[model samples]
Target chain A: MQTTQRPAVSEAVAKSRKKRELIKNVVAYSFIAPNFVGFAVFTLVPMVMAVALAFLSWDGSTNNPITFVGIQNFIDLFQDAKFRQALINTVAYAVITVPLTMAASLGLAILLNQQIRARNFFRTMMFFPYVASMVAVTAVWNMLFNPAMGPVNMILSGLGVENLPRWSVDNNWFICMGTVILFSIWKFMGYYMIIYLAGLQGVNPDLYEAAALDGASPWQRFWYVTLPQLRPTTFFVTVMLTIQCFKVYDIFLMITNFGPGGKTRVLVGNIYEAAFTSRKFGYSSAIAMVLFVLVLIVTLVQFRGEKSMNE
Target chain B: MKEKSGITGGRIAVYVILILLSVLTIIPFAWMLSASLKLNKDVFAWPMEWIPSNPQWANYINIWTKIPLLKYIGNTAILTVVVTLLQLLTSSFAAYAFAKLRFWGRNLLFLGYIATIAMPWQVYMVPQFMMMSGMGLNDKLIAMVCLQAFSAFGVFLMKQFYDGIPDELCEAARIDGLSEYGIWAKIMLPLSKPSLATLTIFTFVNTWNDFLGPLLYLHTDSKKTLQLGLRMFIGQYSAEYGLIMAASVVALIPVLIVFLALQKYFVQGIASSGLKG
Candidate 1:
C-alpha cells in the first residue's frame, strides 16, 4: 500500500518565500518613493519655510536679503488698513457664504429627496454650472451685470425701475460684494445639493415610513427625522464650505478682481499680488502663514466636532 | 383628508421650487448662447434681445479671426491628455502598492500623501515658478503637463478606489503563483474600470479649465490653455460681444460633451471623494 505523505515546506523553500515577500515590499516602496520625495520637497519644505519667513521682512526681489524682525510682521499686520479690510472681507465672506450656502443646499437637498419627476435631469442641470469653466461662467455674469445692453438692466427697465443698481459696478464696494456673493451661491448650490442627496440616501427609509404612518407631516418628518439624520452631513458640508470660502480667488480673479479700490480683494488674491506682483515675498509668506494657521484651527475644530458627534 | 391634501401640496411646492432653481442655474448659459447668435449691433440692445433681431451665424465664423481658438483647443487638448496619461501611470502604480503590498511605514506614507492635497497651490506658486524658470521650462507646454502630473489628489483618489477592491482576489492570484504586478494588472485594474473612467474625466476637466496654473507658468501667449485663450478674445470694442460669446460657447462644448457622457459616475465620484465643497 502506498502511503500518502504530505511534502513539507523545506528550509530553502521557506527562505525563498521570505525573499519573495521582501522583494514585494521593495517594489511597493519604490513605487511610493517618488511621491514622498516630491511631497517633501514641495509641501513640507515650503510649509516650514513659510512659517520661518513670516517673522522676517524681505522685498522678495532677488537682490534683497531677509531682515529678521520677530513678531513685527504680525504686529504690523493688525494695524495695517489693508490687512484689516482683508480680515473683515474674509470674515464677512464666511458669514454670508457659509450660512446661505448651507441653507440653500439643504433646502435644495430636501427638495431633491422627495418623490419627484425627472430628478436626475434637474440635478445634472444644476451641477453643470459648478463644473463650467470660470472663464465662461464669469463672462456670462459680466455680460448680465453690464450696465449697458445687459439682461439685468433690461429686466429692470421692463419693470419700469429707473437707475437699478449694476451688480458689479466699479468702485461701488457693496455692489461688487453682492455680485461675488450671488455668483458664489449660484456656483455652489448644485454641488452641495448632491452632497445632501447622498446624505438623504443614507438615512433609513423605514424611519420616514414609520413617521408617516404615525401621522407626521412632511415638514415634521424633515424637521425631526430628516434633520437629525442629516446633522453629520450638515456639519461635514459646513466645514467644507468654510475651507472653500476662505480659499476664494478664482472667481474674484476672473471677475472684477476685487475691483473698486481693492474692496473685494480676498486673502488668496492678496497673497498672490503681494508675492508675485509686488515682490513682497516675506509679507506674502506672512499672510500665507496666518491663513494656514486659521485653516488648521478650523479643521481641528471640525475633527473635534465629528468626534463628539460620533460619541 | 384636508390636512393630508395640504401636506401633498407642500411636497409639490418643494419640487416646483427646486425645478425653478435648477432653471435659473442654466439660464445664464442659455443667454450666452442666445446672445452669441446676435449681430454686433444687436448684442447690446437695451431690451436685452432674447432672440437676436438679426441673427448672424457669422459670429461663429468670426471666432477664428478674433483669436487662434483652434490652436488653443489643440494646446489645451494636448496638455490635458499628457497630464491625464502620466497621472494614471504614476497614480495607479502607487495605489496598487498602497492597496495590495503591505510594507514598512505604509500607513504613515499614505497619510503623507493625503496631507499634500491640503496645501493650496498658492503656497507653492512662487517657488514652483522659480524652479520652472531655473530649469528653463518657461514658455513651454511640458512645464504645464509636468506640474499637473505631479498630482497629490490623483494618488489619493486612486487609493480610495483600490481600497474598495477585495484582498482575497489578490491572495488567490498569489496562491496560483502569480506575481504581485501580475495580480494588479489582471485583477485590480479590471475591477476598477468605472473608477478609472471617473478619475480620467475629472482630471481632464480640471486640467482643461484651470487658468491660474497656466496663466502663471505659461509665459508665452501661444502656450495658453483654452480659458486663457478665451480671455484674449475679448476686445476693447463692445461690438465684439457676438464673437466673444461665440468663443465662450465653443469653450463650453467639449466640457459639456464630457459631462453628458460620464455624468452618472462623475457626480457619485465627486461625492465619494468627501470633497463636496
Candidate 2:
C-alpha cells in the first residue's frame, strides 16, 4: 500500500510539471503572437517567395501566368548592358562614398569629442540635414547647384572660373555622379558622427593619459589609443555603411533621375525600373537576388574581418 | 609658454573649421526658409536674396490650395500616429517574451527576426507586392500600416533595453501574484520610458518622411502621403520654387517639432541602442 501511494504521488508531480510547461509556452507565444503573425505574413513569407520568384518568369500582369524559367533571368542579367552599367555605377558610388564618409565622420567625431565650447550646438547643426526631408533637401540641392543661376555658380563666376561644370545637369557621368556623392556624404556624415561620438565616449581616458605621459603627440595618441579602442564601433559603422551604400535609390532617383543616359543608374534603380515601370517582376527579383548576394558577401566579409581582428 | 600658444592655436583652428562646416550644413535649410517666404520669380535672384525685401506670406497660404495639401498632411499625421503606437505595443510585447520568458524555441524564433532584419526589404518587395495585392491590401493605407507596423528593429531595440532590466524584478513580481503580462505592463513598461521615447521618435520620423513605401503602395491622390504629395507638387509646378519650398516647409514642420521636443531622447536612443537611424 505504501509503495503504491508513493508512485501515485510521483505521477501527480510529473503530470503537473508538464501542465505548467504547456501553460508557459502558451503564455509566451501569446506575448509574441501579435508581432510574429504580422512579421511572418509580411516579411518571412515574402522572403521565401522572393527566392522562388527569382527562378520564375512573371510580367506582373493578371493575365500572364507565372512560369518557371530556371536560371535564365540571372543569365540574361549578366549579359544585359544596362544591368552591367548599373552594377558598375553602384560599385563606384559605394567605393568612393563609403570611405570618404567614414573618414569625415570619424574626424568630426574626434573633433567634437574634445572639450570644446558649444559642442552640442555644433553637433546639432551637423545632424540637421539628416532629419530634413530628402525631397526638400534634394530640391534645395538642385537649386544651389543649378549651373545657370545657382549661388554656387554665381560665387564661382565671381572667382573668375569659366567652366562652372553643369553639376546636376551635366551629361558627364562623373560630374553627375560626383555631385550626388558629395550630397550623400554631406547629408549622412552627421549620423555616423553621432555613432562615432558614442564610441568615443566608451574609450577609456587612462589610455590617452598614458600615451600623453609617454610623450605621444595628439595624432600618435589618436592612432595608437583612440582608434584601437573604437574598433567595434568602426566595424559596426562599416557594415551599416556598406549595406546602405548598396541600397542607394532615393537620392539617385531624386537627384540624377538616372540621367545622363542612365550613367548614374544604380542596381536598386535597375530593379525599380524593371519591376515597376516595365512590370517584369521575375527579372527584377533576379536583379534583387544579385543585390542580396552582394550585400551578404560584403556583410559576411566584414564579419570575418572583425573576427580575425579580435583574435 | 610654447605649449600654451600651441594649444590656443589648435583651439582657434578647431573653432574655425567647426564654424565653416556649420555654415555649409545650415545653408540649405536657411535657403529653404528664405525661399519659402519669397515670390516664385525672386527665388533664384542672382547673388542670392538671403532675406526678401517683403516676404510673400501668400506662398504659405497658397500651398494649402495648390494640391489638397491639408488632406496629405492629415493622411501623414494619421499614418505616423497609428504606426508609431502599433510598433510600440507589438515590439515591446514581443521583446518581453524574448528577453524575460524562458519558453521553448525562443532563440530560434528570435533568430528569424535578426536574420530578416539584415536582408534588404527591396530584395523581397516584389513578392511582398504580390502578396499584398493578392490580399486586396494594395493601394490602401492599411497595407503600409501592416507592412511598417511590425518592425523587427523595434523588437530588437526594445529587447536590448529589456535585457538590461534584471530578471529578479520579474521573478519578484510573479511571487506577488502578478502574471507575466502584468509584469510586462506594470513593471517593465513603466521603467522603459526612455526607450519608449526613442522608439516613438524613430517610428514617427521614419513614417513621416517615408517616400518609397508610399510611392509603391499608394497611388490614389486621396491616399497619397506628404512625400508623394510633395513630389507631385514638384512635378506640376517645377518652376514655382517659392511655393514648392513652402509646401516642403509645411510637410517638414511636424517632424521638426517632434524631433526638437524629443531631441535628448533621440540622441540618447541612438547612443544606447547603436541603431542606424
Output the number of the TM-score-best candidate: 2
Reference-based TM-score, model 1? 0.92
Per-candidate iRMS values, in order, are: 2.3, 1.6
lDDT measured at residue B270 in model 2 versus the true structure, 0 to 100:
82
**Docking quality class, candidate 1:** medium
Residue A246, candidate 2: C-alpha displacement in angstroms = 0.5
Question: Best-fitting candidate, measured by lDDT?
Answer: 2
lDDT of 2 by residue, A200-263 (tens): 9999999988999999999999899999898888888888888888989999988888887787
* Cα error of candidate 1 at position B159, Å: 1.8
lDDT of candidates 1 onward, in order = 0.79, 0.90
Stretches of candidate 1 exceeding 4 Å from the true structure: A1-21, A37-44, A56-63, A66-70, A170-172, B1-15, B235-239, B275-277
Model 1 clash pairs are none
- Candidate 1 residues B214-264, lDDT tens each? 877776767888888887566344458778888889998999999889998
Deviation in Å, model 1, residue A108 alpha carbon: 1.8
